[model samples]
Target: MTTAVLEFPGGRLTLNRPGTDDPSLRAWSSADELLLQEAFEHLAIAPDSRVLVVDDQYGALTLGLSPFSPDVVADSAQLGSALALNAALNPACAAPERVFSWLQPPVGTYDLILLKIPRETDYLDWLLRWSNGALKQAGVILAAGMIKHLPDRSVDVFARTVNVEKVSRAVKKARLITCSQGEASLDNWPGIWKGYDLEAPGARVNAMPAVFAREKLDIGTRLMLPHLKPAIESCRPCARVLDLACGNGVLGLSVLAIRADIEMTFSDVSSQAVLSARSNVETAYPDAKASFLHADGISGEQALFDRILLNPPFHEGGVVGDHIALRLFEQAAQNLSDTGRLIMVGNRHLGYHKSLRRYFSQVRQLDANPKFVVFEAWRG
Candidate 1:
C-alpha cells in the first residue's frame, strides 16, 4: 500500500490502499471526485446535514465531505482499513463511522446518501431498495462510477427505486446518477434466500447478490471441490479446518458431509458473503459446528488449523493482482499447525507454487485442468 493524494474541489486527501505501488492505481477514482464536486456545487450541504455514504472504496467520499461528518456503510472490511489509515495521514479530517452491510445501519434518517456504484446490478438493486427507506423524505442520492466499471444495467436498476432523477455529464470517464425516492418497494427484490445443489454431496450452496460466485460454482471452485474431501478426511479426528475466503460455505459444508467430526470456520472480507455462508450452513446442516467471521483473511481467528482449504480471490474491488492471495498465504502459514497443510486452487498462470514455497518448506501440485490448478503446501 502507498499514499496518494486526491485533489478535489474544496480540499485534498492523502489516502493509502493495500497492495500494489503502481502510480496508475490511486486511492480515489474519477467518479469519487465527480460525485463530491457535483454535490458540493448542486446540493445543499450544511454542517448539520444527516449524510450517509455507501460503498466508499476507501475514504474519499467520507473524508472529502468531512465538514458534514457523514456515516459509512460498506461490504468490504478492506475498505474500512484503508479509510482508517488514510484518516491518520490527514489528521485534520474526521473519519466517518462505518457499519458492515449485513449489519444494522446507523440510527436515524439521512438527508443525503453518496454511493459508489458496484459492479453487480443485483447488488445495486438491493442497495437502492435499502437506501430508499434510509433517506429523509425529501433527500437525494448521488451514485457514481467509471463508465467502463459500471454494470451494463446499473442505470436501469436505479430507475426502479430511489428513482434516477438526473444524470451528470461524463467527466474524466466517470458519471454520476442523481436519485430520489420513487413509488417503488422491495416487494420482490432478490432479498430472499436461494440455493443451488452440488450433485455428489448434495450440499446446497447459498449466496447473496454481492457475494463472490453468487449463484453458480465458478470453474476454479469446481476444480477444487473434488480435492476437498480427501484433504478433510486425511487429517486426524477432530481436526480444525478453515475455508479461507469462503464465499457461500459450499466448501465447508462439503467437508461436513464427508467428515462431520471436524471443527470448521469460514472467513471472508465481504460481510454479505459471511451472512450467505452462515445461511447456507444453517439451512443445510443445523447441527453443524461452524463459526463465521466477517474480517479480512484470517486476522480475527485465533485458533490454528490442521487443514486450510482456500480458493483465494485474484481481484480486490476491481484491481486484479496476486498481492491479496500472497497476503493470505502468509497469514495461512501463521495460522497453520507445524505439520498442517494448505490446499489452494488458482489459475494455472498465477505460479502460486513459487509463492507458497516462500511460506512453506514444500509445495506440490494436487490437481489441474486447462484453466485451473490446485496446489498443496506444508512445512515439516
Candidate 2:
C-alpha cells in the first residue's frame, strides 16, 4: 500500500487509516475537502473563540482550521493518533488540546460548530441535540458529506434541533448543510436503553446511540450465543475470554452472566461502543473481572486468552470490505492460548472460513442459519 496525502491550500497532510493495515483506504474523501473549504469560507473564529468539530475522520478539518484552536471530537482512538502524528509532521497546525469522544465533548456554547455527517441516524441526532445547547445564539453550524450519505433525514435531524439555513450545491458530489441556532436544548438527548436478551434474561444490556445493535440482539450474535454456551461450559475453570470487536459487549457479558468464573475482556475500535460495553458490564456484573479496551482489534494487546469471541466488522467509513475482518482474525490467532478456541459469527456470504483456515489449524462449523453462520477454530 502507498502513503495517502491530502494537499490543501496551505499545507499537506499525510494520513493512514486507524484499524486496518491497508494504505489505499487512507486517502481523504471528497466530503472532507468540501467541509474544509466551506468552513474556511463561511465559518469564522477569532483565536480566542470557542469552536467545536464533531466526527472528523482524520485531521483534515481539525488541522485545516488549526488557527482557531477548535475542539475536535472523534470516536476512533486510531484516528486521534493519526491527527496528533499529522500535526507533528505539519508544523503549521497544532493538534487539538485533547481528542474528545462523544461521551465527553467540550463544554460551553461555541461560536462555530462543524460536523461531518455520520452514518448512524441516532448518532447524528445525538450530536445535533448536543450542538443545540453548545452553539451560541449567533453561531453557525456547517455540516458536509458525500451526497450518497447526506440524506434528507440527516438534515431533518438538524431541523428538529436547530434551524436549517440552506444546503450548498453539490461540489464534486459533496454537499454542505448549514444551520443556525434554535430554541431546543440538550435536555432530552437519547440516553441508554435497557433490555434483556433471550439468552440472558436476568442480565440487562445497556446501549447508547452509537453502538451496533443498540435496540436489541442482532441475529448474528444471537445465533452465536447458543454455540458459545457449550464451549464456555466445557472450558477449564478461570478461563480468560476476549470479546474482540465487541459491539455492545453482549457476547462477553452474556457469557459472564452464565458463568461467573471467567475473566472477560471487551474490545472495540469505537470509543462509544467501548464505553457502552464497560457501562453494561459494570452495571450487570459489578464484581466481574472485565477489562474494556478502545483499540484497533487487539493490535497492542500482549495478553493471551483461552477463548476469543468475534463478530468482526466488515465495514469502515460506510464502505464494506473484508480487510478489517481479516486483520481481526490474524490478531485473534496470535492472542489465543495453545488450547484456546476462537468462536465467530459472520454473514454466510462473507465466506470467512477461507480466512480462518489461514490462521487456525482446525476450523469447524458449529452452527448456521439462513443468513448467518457460527464457527469455532482452534489455534493449535
Candidate 3:
C-alpha cells in the first residue's frame, strides 16, 4: 500500500491504514489535524513533557506528536499494527516509550493526555476515570472526534469525570474537547464486573464497558443461537471450533452449554472484549477447553477448524461498511478443513449469501428471520 504524508507546521510524517484496499480511506482524519494544530500552535508541549496518546486510530495523534516521544495506549490490536507500520515508514519519528493497555493505567502522572473520544458511553466513562487518576492536577487533555460520530452525551460524560474546559468549533466536520484533571475516582476500570449478569442467546454473559452487546444479547446473535446445535451434530468428538469476532464469548459459551467436548477459541480485536469473554467462559465452565485472543480478526490463526462461527462486524470505529466481513470470509475459508464448514449470522441486508460463494462451493441458508439470516458455507 502507498503511504500518505501528514504534514503539520512543525513536523511531517508518512502513514498508512493497513487493513483495507480502499483508496479513499486515509489514515488520519480532520480531527487529527485539528488536534495537532491546537497542540502545536496554541498549547505548550515541552521536549521533556510526559505524554500519553490513546486510541490514535491509525497513527495520526501519536505520529503527529512523535517529537515528544509520547507513550501509546489503545484497545485495538490494529492500532498497534498501524503505529508500527507508520513508525517504520517514518524512521526519524521517535517510537513510543511504552505501548500499553488503556485498562492498565499509566504508572505515573502525565503532563498531557491525548485521546480520540470513543463512542461507547460506559467505555468513555471508564476512560475518563482512569485518565483523571493518571493526569496531573494541572494537566491538560485533548480529545478529538468527528462531529457526526461524536455522541451528544460525550461532553456530559467528560463533565462527570473531568472539568470540561472548552470545545472547539467544528473544523472540517471534526471537533476537539479540552479538559483538566477531574475529581472522579477509578472504579474497576479494567477488571470484570463482579455482578454483571445478563441473559445471552443460550447462556449467561458478562461484559466490560466497551464490549459489543454488553448489557444484553443483540437480536442477531439471539436469532443465530438456535442454529448452532445443528451445526455441531456433524462434528466428531472433541472437534475444534472457532468463534471469530466473538464478543463477550456468548456464542462460544452457548455452544459450551450444549456440550463440553469441543475445544473453543474466541478471538476479537478489542482488549476489553477478549478479557470479558475470558472471564465469562472461565467463570461458567471452569474446565472447558477455551482460549481467548486479542487480534485483528484471524490474522495469525493457522489451526484448521471443524466449525467456524462468525457474526462479523460491518463497522470499524466510526466507519461502516462490508469490507470487514468480506475480509473475515477470506480468512475463514483459508483456515477451514476441506469438509469443515462456517456458520455465520448477519443482518439480512448485508446479503452474505452471495459473498460466501466466493470462498465456498456451497452456501446454504440454515435459518432466517425478518432482520437476520444464518448461513452455512463449506466446500462441496
lDDT (CA) per prediction: 0.83, 0.79, 0.81
lDDT of 2 by residue, 276-337 (tens): 88988887888998988888677654678999999988777776877778888888888888
Clashes per candidate (backbone, < 3 Å): 0, 0, 0
Worst 10 residues of 2 by lDDT: 190-199
Error of 2 at 246 (Å): 1.4
Please estimate how well model 1 matches the true structure, expressed as its whole-model Cα lDDT.
0.83
Q: Pick the candidate with the highest TM-score.
A: 1
Assess every candidate by TM-score: 0.95, 0.90, 0.92
- Stretches of candidate 1 off by over 4 Å are 42-45, 191-194
Which candidate wins on lDDT? Answer: 1
Which residue runs does candidate 2 get wrong by more than 4 Å?
17-26, 42-48, 84-92, 190-197
> CA lDDT of 62 in candidate 2?
86
Quote the positional error of residue 19 for candidate 3 in Å.
Answer: 3.9
How big is the positional error of residue 269 in model 2, measured in Å on the Cα after superposition? 1.5
Worst 10 residues of 3 by lDDT: 192-201
